[model samples]
Target: MSETKDTFFDFKLFKRLFKFIKPYKLVFFSLIICVVLLAGLSAAIPKLTEFAIDDSMTNKNPKDFVFYVTLMFAALILQTIFQLLFMYYASWLGQNLVKDVRINLFDHLLSFKMKYYDNSSVGVLITRAVTDMERIADIFGQGLFMIFRDLLTMTVVFGVMLYTNVKLSLIVLIMLPVLLYATRIFQKYMKKAFEEVRTEVSNLNSFVQERITGMKILQLFTRETIEHKNFKTINERHKKGWLKTVWYNSFFFPIAELSASITVGLVAWYGGLNVVLSDTVSQGVLVSFIMFIPMLFSPLRQIADKFNTLQMGMVAATRVFKVLDTTSHIDDSGNQIATSLKGDINFNKVHFSYVEDEEVLKGISFNVNAGETIAIVGATGAGKSTIINLLNRFYEIKGGDILVDGTNINQYTLASLRNQIAVVLQDVFLFADTILNNITLNHPEISEETVVEAAKAIGVHEFISSLPNGYHYNVKERGVMLSSGQRQLISFLRAYVTNPSILVLDEATSSVDSYSEQLIQNATDKITKGRTSIVIAHRLATVKKADKIIVMDAGEIVEQGTHDELLKKENGYYKNLYEVQFLQEKVA
Candidate 1:
């Protein structure tokens, strides 16, 4: 969110963008050839006009007139061909370059730690990858090379004008300093205006995405009017930023046009005076000087507008590069692969914190043997879920080590390590796709038959098949078409299909109806029978069947024992928690 440097042009940013053109070097060089051809051909037509007037028309020869006209026609045809080639190849290169950058950015995002996502906005990232990427394409397709073409045309036009008549060319040159000064002023302010516009665009996207996603909560709390006002404020800011650019454009272009028109009038006056009095300037030279002046000034005018396009692209590139430069990704340097990993897990005096000074889990130690089921019970902030996060290496531990199969977890490759554990969380998320695809996540190796069999093993196949299209039914975004309990069932089926060595279910049954809870409990029992499982739940009855229970309080284990063994302790933490939950259940 930091603003890029305030400058007319950024050399480093341009060099970074230019690197994307390397793969298509042949096409790029071909484009340069087209640009040169177009500029040269366009400048020739005006000179041809002078030839037809001075030679063919002056001699009163019909055959010579026809010959020069045909030559002019051929030049026009060649100009058209090169112009077509220039536009096509420029667009093709722009699209391919943007495609590569978008892919690289997406891959970088996937490697980032969860902590980064926790602190960033989904909408801001979407704008960078989607909207801003299109602006970068404009830099190549319409902005950069088009400016080059115009400048080359102007150069040829000015040189030819000077060669033909020095006095008249000086008349055109007198206006150059004033127009160039105006263009410089316009370019500077437009860069700042465009930077502001890009910032406002990102803010608008983030605000709208957040509001729409949370519309249900807004309506439930009756915050519609207040939110509308907030949206108006942001929308107004976005509009004003654009208007400033428009204001600058409105003020600058007329000055350029007026300057060009006055130059033409002055040249005509000077040439007419010489023709009638001294016979110094010929009528053909006067006509061509008139044509040449506009050709010279037109590109100067367009350069200002195209330069704005280039500036906007640079601003976008700066932002995108900032994201690509982030170094917060997890280290995947561990050479160990977790192939055929045993289910044993050990957390030896592990410590962690999301914030620097506020520890969430302090000196936590525990062990689960292969094929053992353990339960963790605690209050909301007692670090129950923190333990699960660490086990999956979603975060790095501050101290001590977590071992899987007697080797430090950090030594195992992340992909290989995570492939061996499956998690089912309380709030499940499903994509807007068929239920079968949602379960398999479009994995090439996971087939529909495997998903169906997994659903049957968890005893949800009958429920799924009863719906329209059975497993192929679309669940819509975030599984909105299904109930909370049904989504939880899908999460379980998803995990079961993986057949992981370690299973972690965090509050998996806390928010379901009694019937759904019973169904989930049965599925849980069947899946955890032989797998090493760790269950965390607020409902004491759910964990009563665990092989061993570890009771946590204030980031430390207060008791470790089986169900009856913990209950036998005199006024113990587990005994108090169980008794309270039992009384609440009886009252309900």
Candidate 2:
């Protein structure tokens, strides 16, 4: 994400957001027009009061008084209609703009490379997508329109005050410079306060999200008190951030009121003096200034308050717009279409590093022919999983050429390439949905009957049938309703039903009961049948019948052979790994 610094406002960010509002230009302009007309009508109200007092009440002219009153009533009616239209159209424009912005951000997120997710916080992204978007929506829905209303009120009110009686107006204007200075100071400090508040809010959200998602682990380890203490610390910081903003608000509003009261006092003192001297100033003009002075000052006070909203909204816009402008996504420039892949895979001298200058995979190379099953065994942090990640183009290799059917993988569109390669990760992720939905993943073409048939072929149909709702059972969040082995079985069935040209399985190392093991082994056999398959081997017995076993150590391949042939070597890497990591599985 691009960094956001505290400024009174961010014009550049608004320029970017204005693009989303382009589609609703007519509605936005109409809202502006209504505000301008409302301001003019509103200014006319005080002038009507001066005319009614001077020409009707003082002179006792019933006809002139009735004329002014009737006109004021007409203005009020027009004002009400414009206000309604302004509100309705403003909301419509804001919601429509926010909808477009939300879709744009989500689409951009979908294109981001896996590397971005690896280093970013999910909670921060959630905050940006949801909370920040709402704040931005308020800019148009409430803040901006209110600001325009208040500003126009002040401008129109000031112009009439000067025109009606210049002497009283100048007396009232004496407080303007001081108030203006105060407003500038308020905007500066409040902008800083809100910037800090948003940061704290994001941090608090990230902490809470992680804690709730990992509540199971916290309970299992009995770390509730420890975690709660940590949460309190974060919560306190969040509260403090908001309190600072409130502090500035508390100080600023009272100062605004004090300034306005002083202006009123000056107007009364000077206007009363002129009347005592029998000067040209009329009583109606003095009273009009009294009424109009507050109108001007009230908007000034309100403008100060609404400017807070405007500033906060802009801060949120800064964050949301940054995401929309992000360029750290997969480059889908390749137009090559993949109708069918031959299942022939090759990695030639691939080099990669998750962090700069710290290689994870060092000059690794491998190949698998069509219809071959290759089992890869390795020690932890040995680049075994990285190879599979590269094959799917999840991460671009630092230096290497990965080809399928002799064409570079980069030459194919990511969608077309990934559609043909299905992977069943060790940590399976299932939506809080029914078993059937989890398997089919809402694919229109993949029917329930087809999913059930695939489950039966993989030998997991009996276990699924025994569940309370069978295929309709809701797994709950992250498949919490299912056991680890049961979830693994579901993952296997999910991959099997995909029927892709190539399959990649990150074998789970967790222990399972004998029954689940038998089901898994059978499912694995069916999925790997007649395809180029790569298995990150976790059990020696599971891969003993494989066509080849490749052993990796510290990003280098040190052993390559079938199970028996590798065991015959005295100090073969595969033999040592089998004894240490998978010996118990073989004994079982």
Candidate 3:
């Protein structure tokens, strides 16, 4: 994140960014042409001034003055038109480039493995996708085109100054090295300052985002004052970062102005002597060079500013490209599509870990027949949910062979494989949208009538009817407006409408009210009727009617059988678990 660590000119990175703008090359290059023309016309203005001062004014000829005035006005008008085109097109190109890059960044994010998210911060990712992208777009708006236009103006001005008076141009050139050295020193300091600013921005955002997300927890613990103090500390650090940048700008601009003023004064002193000593030289030539001196140094001043713009953009681009360059996506090279799967799944000697050398599921094996309901009972972190994640291939197992209908899971295309499985998680997530859209998820293939039919079939239609708008009620972010049971019921309908061959109810009733729990129990019966269903439940009472119940401890399965069969085995894992786990649920 340190700016001094990065090169000012990253051609390779710009080359990568170029692809996004390549689609608009006609517009982009046309803008470049306009900038060049503008620069040329800007150079012509001083020459016309010299002509008006020395020739027409000295001769006192009104016709010559009038003709020169008309030509200068035409050039100024043409320059303005080119300037307009450059402004319009440059902004257009920048906005479009960032739009495409942001989409591409998000799409790449979607393909990453679950483990990537486990170790990364949501706030940092949000900054990269949003704030960092804005810095990049500014490259086109305030950086690239402006930088080029300034440089071209300086270059054209330089050549004209040399042609008009070689000695004055050389005198102005004396300040060039000193100005460049000062800029180098200033840039080095500001680069690190900008880096600190960006890092603090991410930190402040992460702290605020987490606190807001868990505001209820802070309130329950009565720690609002403590959290606010902590937030202020981070916010103060953010202020310090910005102040450092401001401090550098404070010292940098005045010195730059001093140097430009000194350089211009030297031009007047040296050029005036030449005007006195030589009969051939004109005061108008001195006047023209005096004007051209500022033009030459103006781009130099902007190079310092615009280079900062490009500097920030390259920094942002580096972070964005780092995300794009990740090789952490799940291997989705399998071409075999899973169409009409028989719902027979097998996990043979599966071993996996979220972190290296710390396995969560160790050499585990299981089989679910075509239409049997298997309930997995386990303590927290006993890897029951990990099984569901593995089955869906959210994380690649280190050593295992998972088969669906006798074919290895890796042999099936990821999208097709995931399409056949439906999961209603312990914590249901609903979008900030209508109840019906949350259920359908914009799946136009699943008609509105079909979703309504599925909801009623699951026995939760009465609940929906009681709501103000029935199915059309807006869930308003994570379904916070609805009761836990109501959200679970919506999840049920979502799963049913999809008609996935394999159904997973992971603690579907663990945190719901008794009324909604009963409805979910009834819906569970209907949803698991013919599919290969797996229920990971904390309450053993909820799994009594399951075709088979598997008990797990740590990372290994210790016992599994029918409920009645497991009840007879004294001191067995399932028998002991039934007493210990269910008693707690009853007490709560």
Candidate 4:
């Protein structure tokens, strides 16, 4: 999955984003009205100044001068008030739009399948959610408002100037083309620079996040110096990207300033000649024309600056859309829903692979009768967990069919299928929340009594009770605050809380100490009672209690029988595994 290279000004993306603003149209229209009013006031300022110079100052009319001055002040005050309203409404609308966009994005992301997350990076997705969304908000709030005000002011001022003096306006207008050309060129370069900057910033954030999350591993290996060097490299790359953006901005502003100066100088020279030739046009009108030239160019310069911001915003939008545009490889096609399930599982000629032409499970067949426990033992990467993943429909099988209760698993709604199956993985994960919350994660409606009962059934309630806040104790990110045993216990309780018809325990007790292992073994015995279960374990003792044991090797099931039956196969994989563990027991 490659990041999108599409530009930010993509019409389709803007059209999609504009939908978020539609709900707040009334506020948006009010903002536009304020902007137009402010622009009209801005253009009127120079005219008022011109009137004061011609009639009040030249003719020496004190009462008229005072009156016009008061009117000018009143307009200034009105512009300020309208400007405040414009800012308030624009901010309100932008924030509301951002909230709406984020909610929609999050809802869509949650509906995506596991395959989507498998191909995407956590850091990149997080950047889109936080940083990219913020940039879009800033553009909608500040950039859009400025664009509207500057455009309206530019148009009105130019019209007035052309009407008052056409020749001078023509000269000033010539500079407009130059300004537009310069802005166009700058916009192209700035787009690439901003994209690079955003990429580098994402890289820096990824590095920092990984380092902090893996601080213990770095310290254990004494790799602080190497980590420091790696961070420095990322930091330097970000700095270089920033420097490039600054360089382009440096060139952009100077060109804009020079263009403004030339336009003003041209207007002054042409208007001055007109005044010298005849007294038809007042000195006030000439002064006003000069003022109008900068007024016109100032907005042009602003548009130039806004062009840069708009490009940056486009870059951010491109990133955000990339996440939103990703197509999930796995999708639920069936509409079947079941209120309950009888766990009769069958894997008929199952063939599977993570990638094409690389078979992980080949021609595998298995069956588990309702209310039975089966153990699948295999060497590392021998497809033990792959079998469990397929059973849960986490990854679709490339060939063959898996059925539950004589119906193909794919024929069932994904939610209904998953709700009936619970998995306790080898590497247990717990959210940074209360113990009660973690256990009740799948069933928030379950009462505290149910949570406590589930935790007690898993032998975790006693430990949780010893905590400072009991079940309400915060776990810290990824349950880092808890012991490995405690985390495993919580995972067990979570699966148990679901009361799933079919339970899959993949190395569920591997990481815990012997004391916790005994507790887990007892808990498993209780939980697996009368429930169809698949147990994947490395420890021979754990599978010894299973009703049936299947051994796998090289993507094929090599042997299948009860524990005693497999132990009797003198040369089989299961026999060898039993011998190794039995010998280790003797040595201990």
Candidate 5:
């Protein structure tokens, strides 16, 4: 993520944020009304004090004193009511907007191609969705309207001060430029500090998420000490980012305080000289001016602080909008739906690359007639998995075409196309959910009975039933409670229940024990009986029964034939690969 430049106010971002207000315009306007009332009432209280002291105290009139004090009390009550309304509605508006934005962001993320996930950090994306979104809520809750309210209150306070006595008002105005300059400097540096703080927060989240997820690997390699040191370094940088903001606050706030105190001192000195030397300024006016100076300065102080809040919110908004603005999603413009697919697949000179100009699949071509079983074999990074990804439209090919049922894959809707295929990947990911929910992925249409029947057909029903909760047992995160073979069986069961026309098992049987392998072999035979199946396996034995074997090396197919025919070519890629694996099995 790149740094968001330090900007005191971004009008475009503000305008974009206000667009969320369209849904809750009534609450927004009511909140505005409350803010206006609160500011007006707050400013009016001090004037009532000026009247109480001048008309009643100096004249020794008790009735006037009672009248003015009663009015001040009523104004205070009204101020409290409006303040409560302001806080509640402001928070309500902010939280609702956050909810909407968070949902949109998550939905947008779901639409992105697998290629996006390949390059982006999970932890960083999580921070943007969760932490950064919370910061945006502050824009409404404490930022824009609060700043406006303070400015309005200050305007009223200044008008009253000037009306009461021009000389004292002039004295108060003398210190304004010095304080304003200090605030401007503070606001500029604070924005930069906040940007650093947000950046460090994202870094910390990404580091922690990756570290926790890969903790097993870290421990297996005995890198605890090194990892601890690395974490400390990142954490220290996060601390320093925050400390910069603290330093700025500590420096600027005192300057604001001293300026306010000096203005009050100057007002009192000038007003006192008038009260004694001449009757130009009354003691009542002097007292009111004393009360008004802080009002004028307090808003000035709060405006700077609120501006910092506004900056932080805008920075967070910029990061979020960047994600929303990305066009990395696979095009879903095709309107054709894949229904009752015959499962005929053809890859016509397909070319693809994860990185620019470095092909992962180079002009790869193959054909699978309806209900035919094919196996792809190669060394690691031979682009075997890339074939499965393209088949499922998880990624778009750079050149050539992938056709399903004799129709170009791009012509079918992405969801409908993917629904016709079931892929059980090498690395199985299971949410922390019940076995039933994990198999059905919480689809309301798939019942427990259907899952059990599919499991029985796949030969894993007894294994799942033997668990503590039977079919309802929780798999935990990534099925950590189950052994590697058990997890693979669950993944196979998940695919079988989908009953897709085209089934893909990518190295599904490679990691299982002998017993699990036999069960998987039985399951494989049962599910692939009349469905188009593509199996990519490292073990030669697993692909021996495949209708056709396609040999791939680097990014291109080297050979394609039946198990017996491929071995007939003495120096062919498949013959050599089969010979090496056979020798390895003999050695074992």
Candidate 6:
């Protein structure tokens, strides 16, 4: 987010990206060869014109003029052919590179702990993977090729001009310093403008994504007008940023053009004077000098423009690398795999904090035997969710070891540890896919029969069967097409499909109707019958069936007992919570 002009061309990031192109080395080399050939043919065209003027025009030889004209046309044709090949290869390479980078980035993102998603915006992350990667691809495909072509053409033209007419070449060379200085200034403004553009774009993307996703909340609050006005303000800022970039580019092109023209003009004046005064240089040579001067500056202008593009691309690349540079707070440290988990979970005097020096869970310890169903109840922010998060290894405990099956959880690969756990959250999220796919996310290799069995076990198969497409019904984004209870049912089915040793249901039925809640309770009871289950619920009824109830308040466990024992407590948190929910149910 900072606009500081740090070095955007990160060599490490380039090295990683370059590895993706290694498989297409031959195509890459061929493209470079084509670019060189195109540059050579382009540089030779002006020389051909010079030959036509000096040899054919001066001598009035129609045959020679026609032959040279034909040769020039042939050169143009070859140039076009090679240019096409170069472009095709460049485009292919760029697109493949983008694809590879995106795939790798996506995989890397998945490997990160859930905490990364908690701290970052989905919209900005999506933009980095799609838009920013495309911008970098454009640089690799077009910008780098242009830089090479222009450099080659400029070098060849200048060398040829110097050899043919040293004095005039020297006069034209004077413009180089001025061009370089102007470009230096242009790059400064251009880099700043480009950084601003990327910032504005990221902000706009975030705003749009938030607005769309929170449309329901906006309607509930009747704040659509306020949201629209905010969006308009963001739009105006983006427009202003874009216009500033455009104006800077507008000034840049003309400065480059005027400098090129001035260089050509100086050459024409000095060359004509030398010829008129001493007759030392022939008319043909003077004419060639005039033509070559413009040819040389044309590539110069291209180089300037390419440099501007490169700067912009570097800005995008920096943003992308920032994401890649973030270190995952939770990472797998062990290569060991637990062949089997007995689900004996132990929290040994654990301490944790989202921020330094502020512990959320302090010196807490608990243990649960295999196949035991434990319920965690607490006031809001009483660290109930945080405890479950630790059990899932979503956040590493700052101080103490969490052991599974009498072995430290960190002693096993994260995948190995997580593979044994299944979670069903209150706010269930389903991908845009068939109902069957959502339930079968964990076990895509499972047969359709198995999918139906799992759905039926969760009491969702009947509802799905009633739909026109049954299990094949498409779940729109975030399962928007399904009701909340239906989403919860599908989520439970998904967890069941995984067949995990440890089950976590975090308020899994809190948002559902009574009927759906009963369905979920039945399904959860069946699924957790022989698994180590941790259920966090706001609705006390859901946890009454739990084997052991642990009450938490302000990050510490206040009480632990069976349902009957907790009910007998005079003023315990669980008893109070149960009374409140019971009164609410009676009122309903």
Tell me the tens digit of each residue's lDDT in model 6 across 389-470: 8877888889988999998888888888887898999899999999888888746577789988887777778888998799
Residue 137 in candidate 1, Cα distance off native in Å: 0.7
C-alpha TM-scores of all predictions: 0.97, 0.95, 0.96, 0.94, 0.97, 0.93
Greater lDDT among 3 and 4 belongs to 3
lDDT against the true structure, each candidate = 0.89, 0.84, 0.86, 0.83, 0.89, 0.82
Which regions of candidate 6 are displaced past 4 Å? 1-17, 269-279, 583-588
Model 2 poorest 10 in a row by lDDT: 1-10
Candidate 1 global CA lDDT score: 0.89
User: Candidate 2: TM-score?
Assistant: 0.95
What is the clash count for each candidate, in the order shown? Answer: 0, 0, 0, 1, 0, 0
TM-score, predicted candidate 3 vs. hidden true structure: 0.96
Q: Which pairs of residues collide in model 1?
A: none
List ranges where model 3 is wrong by over 4 Å: 1-6, 273-280, 583-588
Top-down TM-score ranking = 1, 5, 3, 2, 4, 6
Query: Of 2 and 6, which scores higher on lDDT?
Result: 2
For residues 1-588, write the lDDT of model 5, one tens digit per residue.
Answer: 344655567887778877877999999889888877887898798889989999999999999999999999999999988898898889889989999999999999999999999999999999999999988998889998888899898888888777777878888989999989998899888888888999999999999999999999999999999999999999999999999999999998999999999988888888899899997998888888888888889889999999888888888999999999899989888999998799999999999999999999999899999999999999999999999999888888999999999999999999999999999888888889988888899878888889988888777889998999998899898889989899888888889888899999999988889899889889888889899999997666668889999999999999999999998997989888877885586477
- Determine which window of 10 residues in candidate 4 has minimal summed lDDT: 1-10
Displacement of residue 566 (Cα, Å) in model 3 is 0.4
Candidate 4, clashing residue pairs?
8-314
Off by over 4 Å in 2: 1-7, 276-279, 508-511
> How close to the true structure is residue 477 of candidate 1, measured as C-alpha lDDT?
96
Q: lDDT tens digits, residues 4-92, model 1?
A: 57676677777887788899999999988888888888778888888888888988977888888898999999998899889989989
